[model samples]
Target: MGDIENIDNLLALEALLQVTFHNRSLLLRAITHHSCCSETALRDSYDTLEFLGDAIISAHVVEYIYRSFPNASEGDMTALKSEVVSRRVFALIGQQLGLFPFIRVDIANLRTFNERSRDSLCADVLEALVGAIHIDQGAEVARDFVARAILPMVEQVSVQADTNPKGRLQKIILQRTGSLPRYRVLEQSGRNNDRIFLVGVYDQETLLGLGKASSIKEAGRLAAREALETLQKQRGKASIIDVGDESQPQL
Candidate 1:
């Protein structure tokens, strides 16, 4: 879909977000991407608000983790907050909220979102919306918006902390090697929205494992699990998995 002709046509969006902007222009700008705006444009885009929103979201997520899981160790809390309080989660929430349709983006760039992305434009809009709400409605309302939109994801993250392959692999890697695993997209194929991603999991200079899936995150999970299995099997047979001297693969 193409960018809309007018900014005031956001009543339905307000209803969906359960937030009415007294200054409707703020809401308008919150959804406007720079690609659809120009140097001579009179109005600003979501970039500034996104910066403020990032801080707000991080603080709230940290506070939530601290207050909700009192029994959790500091390490666990920090890990959860660091891994789960991310742009991916925010983008997923934005998709769930049906916010993409209202975003003011160049039509040419609209289809780019079909691929799996770690840092998504939808996240920017989501954060900008939070910033707008904070500006127009105040802290309480912004917190409420986050509570309604983002808080639910925290429990899922906590529950999956040990079970998810990527998180589990990360913890194990850190304990064993003192280095986190990095994932890089290796390949992509397929048509339009049905594209597949091949991701490789690497430990510093060593290629741990590779996995392919419909999305980058899923591919990363598979790669992580493969790496974990490889580590386990290698440990079972011998103490260490040898990494011969070879040039590092640039990710």
Candidate 2:
């Protein structure tokens, strides 16, 4: 929101993104959170640009998956896309870009920010940066940015998605219940950086599993894995019970 005063911030950000901006103001706005905006009426924050960038990034990711995975089924491509294009993944990638120090937020909020809030902020800012690039340099440059920053993650995500417990659980639940399994945060503790997430997966009213990890997404994955294992055991027990039923009449 500052006028021509955040030049140093702009230069550092440009170096980080490796894309110089002609409209430095746009870049500045991209790093500026809504809390820093002094006026509600003025266009001063990354919120709108983040929205646009969400669509732009999704489009680019979808196109890339469609072309690169031509032999894959629709379900496969979708599963791959879901892993790589998620907010948690984006936040992880954004951290590697070293964008945190350049972001402008209210001092109070910044001080109190937890890992979840930090991840959300990083993801939103990355999207806003793409939106700013699309506006200042056009769609191709924006695509290039994503190619450099985001697409490299697809291979890693693909490997994980191949055996992704979360995805597997979703498929099973969707097939059996005609609805996806739900996850709930059970507990949290520790400081901002060291925070832990305890999550539980549920099938309607039944609790299938619980897991604890440093991130919500990872915790959810663990919970799903547990649920799958539990289901397998239950099936095994059912099979044993059926075999032990000697009350059945012989044929």
Candidate 3:
């Protein structure tokens, strides 16, 4: 980690993100990880910015979906929103922006950093960047950045909506049990910046399946998928009526 006064890095980042920062310090702060904050003498970390950014992204997404899909049901709108605001989606966009090279982290922390940590870091930095943009410019500019840089990913999600396990599971459970599926964060571990989430999906009072992943949303989706598969298997079994002739049904 170095000083935030590096003009070259600032210029490079501006070029990379296709957004100019009026305040370069916000840009630097956006890319900084919490692990490097104390060592770099930065009084502010990206956490606060990330929080703001998360809300900003969510609001924009909700508005976008609501306007774009006026006839869509609440469940459909929710499904689409989930795809857009997901941590996995954010991390993928971050990777496309080449954010990893620009992220500042302490060397000691680097040793323990795995794919999970990388995904979380990229996701956080992207959100923080959004926060930074909103602060330095305005909501319109931030919205433009999101629309230009990140919104295109929505196409992929739209195409792959059929493969969304959570949505599929929701439909199947609603049809079969006439009840909504429930998800709970069963456990969380690791540092705040790179926590592992364990989520469980329940059908009413019974625990149907469990899943673990880098983010709670992903973990919940996985759990729903597992539960869906389990329910499908249970449904696959032949009933007594199906196993024998209906004409000889008397016991």
Candidate 4:
């Protein structure tokens, strides 16, 4: 079974988070995935720690935003907190921390999962680490750790949160043309495990773009992104044409 000695990465992470653990075993337990211990019959894993850490992280983030942005309304702060604590944002943070390098996973078939899977795993580890920190130290220490490690990345997270292609296209259409973008299911196919959906985006009576994905939501987002790109290109060309026409001599 793996012990604190097996976790060389913890030392580096300790330096990064700027907090030393009183109980090194707790930190090791925090990073230990169920898969790792399942094979060795080890009782401790990070799942419970992850659950606790998630709650602590949420509370810490909300309180930080609430105090920092006092002039901002509750709804805005809530929206910001939701984005900040999102899985996607946390996964990005994990990637930045190089958490993947420290993860202990099965060596076989590891190459097949791709970067997305690795990112998801790393994100989970980060949450578990937070839980471990809370347990080893206290709520205040965990809060400070989160504030130091995560708060600096809030601006980046906010930018990415707003870049959801579907939402972006919807907002642009509504603001520019005073109309909401619409979606239609073009087709769906395949079985439960590997289903595919094709969807199209429309503006009023006109079809803007079409796309396909494993899920209807993803297909719709893809279609919206395509439409947004097309719209932007058309606008750019129109502007260029207008400028050219203006620059030409009157005949």
Candidate 5:
């Protein structure tokens, strides 16, 4: 709710993060915002740590994706990374960890800002905390922090991917033929901002499915869903739909 400058506050934060800071000043600085600090005292802010934490989180995320998804392509890994390191994801993590209350901000500015702005601020503070942890301890400790706070979300991501039509189709195609399904835009029409895209999905030489949507991604997903349904009809018993009971959203 206020500046986390006191010993008790720092200790509580340490408990929350499950890491004991050798240099407590780093922890204090990580929770302080520049808006709340004077020019002369700006060094007390979390800015520097935020910068460092961005790199720290990114490196760990890339490593995590590479090792966890051994079969995933570079593009796939990158897509997962983008989702994991996204501001929205970080903001959700930050909120869950109660980082917002500890952040020291200019009350006037904070009051004027909207929910989106506050979420961005919370995400920044979360990154700064990661930076501080890295500086105060090391990569191993920072990794522990990430595992505790961020990696749990990886499971959720997996579940989302599992229920995704495109993800399901990719896994099925890859397992059945050891080749990924390809989606190509057959035609695009309408205005630039509100354009329509017709996409076709192929497995090797066969056109498995076709779909039309406003965006390339949506069209691809729809095509994948259609492909899955088609495959199910052809195979009868052995189909991707029978692979799991996970409910997929309609693309």
Candidate 6:
């Protein structure tokens, strides 16, 4: 997109974000990537803004969590912040905001990268925007933006605490069975830009379950979850069978 058109689109996005910046130039800089401008150019890029926004986002998220969950300890708040500020989470938020379509990247320079790789640009733009908002509007506006746009979507905190399958499975197997659960890389395939993996969960050489995902960590978690479910089922059935075995047999 042309410079004027890009500015117009950014203004429209600002409206959608419900933020009016006192310094419109900062907003423009936030959306403009280094790829959009050459090194010798007079105009500033989004990198500095992204760095500032990273700090702002983390602080706001931590403050919100602190107040929202007064009973939660510092460690719990730190874990929550890590998950919320992860690259995956930011990319997902950028996608939700439809920032990719509005980003201006030279097609010639980006022909080698896949869609997932290009998404990093969108994430950077998001951080830059946050930085711009914090600078122009202040911390309250930035906090409100995060609360409205990002906080509500982070509903998996409790689920994360309870169903940390990998940790729970490891502890259970080690305590009861006196052996740690093993993970095997069952398969790995996909394009160089985006790889997929399938992993299996084994308990003492017994293949208990399997799972597949776009990342090895995710695949391992899925396998552990499946193994946990399988073990629970076996325990339930054994309980039932044990009760039956205690009953008197009919002649």
Per lDDT, the best of the predicted structures is 2
Worst 10 residues of 4 by lDDT: 107-116
* Cα lDDT of model 4 by residue, 224-251, tens digit: 8789889989999999999999999999
Can you write out model 3's per-residue Cα lDDT over 1-251, one digit (the tens) per residue? Answer: 34554677888999988899998888988988877777554455788889889999888878877887789888888878887888878988888888988887775856576787787799999999999999999999999988887777766776665337877887887987999999999999988767899999988889998999878977988898788778767766645446666667588
Q: TM-score: which is higher, 2 or 3?
A: 2
Clash count of each predicted structure: 0, 0, 0, 0, 0, 0
- Model 6 per-residue lDDT tens digits across residues 1-251: 66798678878878877897787777777877676687732467888889998888888777777888799777666767777787777888888888876666666655466766656887887888888898899888988888887776456655555335787788889987899999999988997658889999988999988989778887898898888889889999999999998896867
Taking the tens digit of each residue's C-alpha lDDT, what string does model 1 give over 101-159?
Answer: 78877757454655353237678888989999999999999999989898888898787
Lowest summed lDDT window (length 10), candidate 5: 109-118
Which has the higher TM-score value, candidate number 3 or candidate number 4?
Answer: 4
> Given candidate 6, what's the lDDT at residue 2?
68
Off by over 4 Å in 4: 1-7, 39-43, 71-73, 107-112, 159-180, 184-200, 205-251
Q: How high is the CA lDDT of each candidate model?
A: 0.81, 0.86, 0.82, 0.78, 0.82, 0.79
TM-score of model 4 relative to the true fold? Answer: 0.70
Clashing residue pairs, backbone N/CA/C < 3 A, model 1: none
Please list the residue runs of candidate 3 whose C-alpha ends up more than 4 Å from where it truly belongs after superposition: 1-5, 39-42, 162-164, 173-251
Residue 97 lDDT (model 5): 92
* Model 5 clashing residue pairs (backbone): none
lDDT of 4 at 173: 85
**Candidate with better lDDT, 2 vs 6:** 2
Q: Name the top TM-score candidate.
A: 6
What are the TM-scores, per candidate, against the unseen true structure?
Answer: 0.70, 0.73, 0.69, 0.70, 0.63, 0.80
RMSD list, candidates in order = 10.1, 6.7, 6.2, 5.0, 9.6, 3.5
